[model samples]
Target: MRLLLATAAAAALFAAPALAQDPGHDMPMPAQPQPTSDMAGMSGMRSMMSAALGDYAINREASGTSWQPDASPHAGLHLMQGPWMVMVHATIDGVYDWQQGPRGGDKAFVSGMLMAMAKREVGDRGTVQLRAMLSPEPFMGKSGFPELLQTGETANGVTPLVDRQHPHDLFMELSGAYAYRLARQDSLFVYAGLPGEPAFGPPAFMHRLSIMDSPEAPITHHWLDSTHISMGVVTAGYIHRNWKLEVSRFRGREPDQHRFDIEAPKLDSTAARISWNPSANWALQASWADQKSPEQLEPDENIRRWSASAIYTVPFGHGGYWSTTAAWGRRTSAHGDLDGYALESAVRPNLDWTIFARAERVASDELALPPGAHGPAVTVGKVSVGAVRDFSLTPHWSFGVGGLYAINFVPGALRASYGRSEPQGAMGFVRFKLD
Candidate 1:
């Protein structure tokens, strides 16, 4: 029954304070304040009821730490009363894939989430917010049928296959926002819902289009910053102090429809970002993106891209820390064309271990093949490595484990009928948290 109406809407949103403390109240009753460890203003009341139930409010703060580098025991919950706020998060994972088929079957996974936010506070500096969210559905495991395609076949291709099931990616989002507090470090934040879709770097875990924690498999290429399925995006940003600025615009259609012409004229994307921290350990970031795609039929073919990256962090001794990053990019298309470069590193010998590595090289062109198709249309090099650990076991809770490996050198019938060379893979995960 749709998992019993999503477990009775997550037990009536966590038993709504025991149904508002019922006891046949007649009046007098007000004394309940004491619970602080900073929950970021109750995570903005579940992002204002998930932007009034249209979804997409994905994180406005509710706790921090774990910005990936592999460390997940997961812990987050924020609750507030007055204007209203509520947030909940849960995660369970165990994935092991060594590739082969049945699309590499599966191994283990589980995930859950719930969110709500509502706000009003319209004095002094103004405020208005609304939001909502829910998630569940992800599972995998099935693969056995290749000994050279099961010899001459006689049935019993290792059994397993009764219509094979395991594929899910559920979603929901709603949003609305208005803010003003142009002081105390500055603020302006104007929002328009249908948000969720910000998975930069590492191509969001090498692009599988993220969604795991059992929302029914397909994880990596990072996509659950709370789900923003399509179109409509506008952001104007600034952060003073350590320096930060942003400009954004993302119109619509292109979340894996693989571009089949949605009447064209709606893939206009623009982005700009700048970050700086001149001293104290030094820091810097720069970004730019542009996607036109509207006029086609020849005439220079349209479709362009550009990229750049740089990072450096050093602390050493005592608590230990070290970092490095480098990146470069280019792209053009009528069908395909690309150029790439990358380098990465990480180290942290204390506070619960850490280590990382990366290398990359890419060259492509072959704008939609089929005239003779030989080698060298360009396609080469790739590599990866990973490790992470964190154990806080108390003061609330924590746990984690990680592993990763990837490779691609292209070859074999031009990387087996290339769809952008895909081979060599490895992964592992485990996490739990409560605070």
Candidate 2:
């Protein structure tokens, strides 16, 4: 029944609005000739909503390539009418894995997403956009998918998540924004979402091409981009050419165990981010958030978190690119403060081979323990690499089988019971995508 309701909601969302926006209406416009200056007045809003601008309105790459390195790689379906454009972005990632660790489990599951965005001219110098995103994760079981030492959120009702990535809720975002042009290169906007992300962290790791091939969440997910699923958010921003500044009010709490339900929205937290693209090949961002009780088990705590990252992408042979990212994150709380750092890269040297690697140093408190003892804060380092060869069966379908290997540098306190500082994991997968 839950699945049914979710499916209905998605269908309704997609169908209803699209019909209302159909350009088939018989209404005719009564127009008078406008001066060239007046036509030029709306350039700012047009630049933001124009298809010629590639699909990203917010981040412009370093050298101004149509491909925005910071934006997620996507296969889109689009429609352009008079002064409006509508689009859909979707993907799914799944894998089979085997791993050795205190908090690791082997399994097969997919992480999938469907997002839609629609924009239209609001007035002479104004534009409005609506965005909706959804995911289905409940069928994967209660304990959640595997990772060496990821921890955050809750699962199976009231149980704190430890060393595993929790399932995303059915609805990830349902938001809207209004933008007004201030000048040829300037725009101001206000955004609100029931369940939306704030201006913090690198675009969710899952969306970064540098590590898109990796199925596991980064071990340092909580320290950086956990708020990508915040239940309520409102953001205000200013965009001028290749730079943007944004501040947000959002619910700090991560989603609870019920992946099928939309939790209540709370505006108990705040965050700010500033990003710039010096050239089309590079994008840099820095952000901070003051959050309250983001984790259920750590209810009394408040977290002041900071993150920064540099992302670079250079287009190459056959719809491929070399993408890389380096990021740092820190979280300060009453009990202690910890830091996390990550570097990763992905390259498709040729049409047939896709390769990627990542290294991370994470601070963990949830798994810092001995057989019969509790230990101090500990930091662990993890590294992984993988490759896939494409065998195309059709233009939109292909078969891919890949392998990955990961090793961990366990802290001394955990070395005793965990046996050795090194625990290993590997995975194999078959993938599908739109061309």
Candidate 3:
């Protein structure tokens, strides 16, 4: 108990500063007129906004102009200057997360990502869009973020991180797309990028409205959306009203240890997804992917993955809402098949307080342990609950302090390494976000 308290105190120091704004989707910024001296940049931006948004004055989340029928809200910097409509999302999460059980400890770090996108109508024909995303983890460290039992990718970008959350690359994503509107509610588009995501899983957790309040990566990340950083990806999609069909071909190799450089592109993997937004308050998807060689250490292994998920959000009072997600996924490999499931949710009744919980069961590998500790496939279950107190430092940014405790259920074979039958972990963090 004392340790947890100390951890929380340290987290407070980490939040001394931070982002410009959150993605508040409903907030609208009045367009600034063309420039005069000090406003030159505003003029150019205005011109870009006019060309892209047309009469689409509101911001809606989804890929390109393929609107999510019931997209959740986000508060972001919306630049609607001229011919371009642009959106920028960024945040720096400073964590002092301390986990107790088997693979837990006083692990901490400050990591975040910045993503910017812009679109413009092309010659009265199609909509052209460009996106850039970056994170500074490459030069930061090799161990990446610490999360109990979290495994995938490599820590050094070479050896498997084993039980840690892999750091995102400095260039998380660099991509572009072109879309042609066929009707008021229909469009066809093509998107391509280096270090991009295929049409496989839900938007990566960081971007998901359901789990945005938590700092730790979901243990099921591997089975669900591990391909968020494919070396190369080309996606083609058709959107009709509240539904979208997408297919993609992408390089399957995980990024090598050299975080600063781009990996070789193989275009050896494929995936498809069907997304339905039955209403403006819910989103659903089913997806499948075949990755030829996603991990460097397991070059001979081919992975076939499938997943389905439902996300829902309902606005409440005073800038608050209820958001949740439940997802299931599976991976089939030569070794065997493993299933992963997660259900998480958060509710904020007001701006200052939030409550959240998560429960997950995932397949873990004993082989991921040191060579001598190798065993067979192991299944684990964990449940956690947490809350955060946000100090609204400003209208656009906020600092928060929160803690979570988790209970784990482990199989006997894994007991030797975990040290006990049931281990528990706890984390405390100072979270900062563009609010």
Highest TM-score model number: 3
Flag regions of model 3 displaced more than 4 Å. Answer: 1-71, 371-374
Q: Per-residue CA lDDT of candidate 2, range 1-435, in tens?
A: 233234434433342221111121111111112225665435433433352222343323211111234332333444333344555555566678777855556899877676666666776677776777777566676667877666777676566666577777778777777878787668887878878788888877766778876776788788877787788898888877778788999999888887777788889999998887777677888999999888776678889999999888776544566889899999888767889999999987765678999999977667754211224678888899999877766433456667788887887777765567898888787765433
CA lDDT scores, all candidates in order: 0.39, 0.68, 0.69
Indicate the worst ten consecutive residues by lDDT in candidate 3.
50-59
433 Cα displacement, candidate 1 (Å):
4.3
Evaluate residue 391 in candidate 1 and report its C-alpha lDDT on the 0 to 100 scale. Answer: 79
TM-score of each: 0.28, 0.82, 0.84
Give the runs in model 1 whose Cα sits over 4 Å from its true position: 1-48, 52-75, 81-398, 402-409, 412-435
- lDDT string, candidate 3, 1-435, tens digits: 233223323323332222222333332233433356567655454334332222232333443222322435544544432555555556776776665555656666776776666666676557776777777667557777656667777665346776567777787877777777787667787888887888987777777666767777888988888788788999898877767798999998877767788887779999999887787678888999998987777789899999998888877666677888898999998878889999998888887998888899998663346821335778888888888898977645688888878877778877777778777777777866653
Residue 379 displacement (Å), model 1: 6.1
Q: Over the full model, what C-alpha lDDT does candidate 2 score relative to the true structure?
A: 0.68
For candidate 1, give the lDDT. 0.39
Q: Best to worst by TM-score, what's the order?
A: 3, 2, 1
